[model samples]
Target: MTLAIENGSGKATQWQKVMVVAEPTRESAAALHYVLSRVVFDNDILYLLHVENPTFWKTCFKKQSSSTSREGGGCYGGCIGGDVDFLDQMKSACEVVHPRLKVKVSRVETDAKEKAYVIISETKVHGIDLLVVGKRQSLANAILGQSINGTIRETAEYLVENSKCTCVAVQRKGQTGGYLLHTKTHRNFWLLA
Candidate 1:
């Protein structure tokens, strides 16, 4: 792929809406970084979507509960401080960049399993041109079946297949330093940038 780091190639074009899914994890942070550093260009409206899964407390955090501070008095002050840090960086990036970027944040309440549907609806609502989601992969999907719910991190896969616009599911590839991207056209493609 062309890594020109430019919005449009050979023509003056700007995507109206670019939606990037936001979560508190480092995977999500990397996705946001990818959007801000690589995909976005002048006049693009950036959208940060945080799907607040109502059952996340019960469903997502079990032994991995320590990853996010859902402990100590039920997911309020002790949860998701990474999001605030990310937002601050986002704002700073917008201010520093030459492009006049506009960012909008949305928080939608839904069940964990239906996250893909909610994301798809948001794209339709905003007419998003490109959608970016941080993929949190689970070995359980392979060990168990795709029918499982609690470790339902496969929502990105569903979105890649179903979203009306171009959807990219990003997963950071640890210390090797790369990203694993899933698109309608690509599966587990290693993206160096």
Candidate 2:
């Protein structure tokens, strides 16, 4: 079955707070595009949640310009590195589709917690009605024997099972095919256009 999206803005529905875990990945951008173009309504609040992993800094940045130490090279603070550009593009696309939609940027640190747990916490704290995250299979996943189809990595799976709000883990099927959608009750369901 396809993922159902109701765009009945004329109906009397509660204002929704929809959060999408934004990362600098093709799958993440696809998820954002899906939500902006389908799931979110004009009155909904869209939140882009970025969880900064300190370990990522080791490979991505040289120094901490805002808070602490400089490690290897350049500065990185208040930025999701250069990937924030993609985030801006996603926001612009959302605005073009939903001019009245309110998009909020939430930047948080993992703070040594599991990323999934951090996401769940944020969902509860924000009282989100819906949450979306990208699902992708990596080489490490294959080596770890997590080569299951339609099942996302640990983060999306854990978020789906534990988050307070309804969660969707999605991977784009192709440029025009639609998406591979997963939810608490659905796994690897293909939502074709």
Clashes of each: 0, 1
For each candidate, the alpha-carbon lDDT, in order, equals 0.74, 0.76
Q: Against the true structure, whose TM-score is highest? A: 2
Question: Which stretches of candidate 2 lie above 4 Å from their native place?
Answer: 1-13, 63-84, 111-113, 139-153
TM-score of 2: 0.74
Tell me the tens digit of each residue's lDDT in model 2 across 41-121.
877889999887877666455444443534433543333544347567777878898999999888787753577888888
Q: For candidate 1, lDDT tens digit of each residue in 1-193? A: 1122354566545356789887767777778877877788766788888887766645444424545433443354114432355555555665576358887878899986788899999999988889999877777766775447655447777888888899999988875577888899988899786
RMSD of each: 6.3, 6.6
Lowest-sum lDDT 10-residue window in model 1: 73-82
Q: Local error of candidate 2 at 101, Å?
A: 0.4
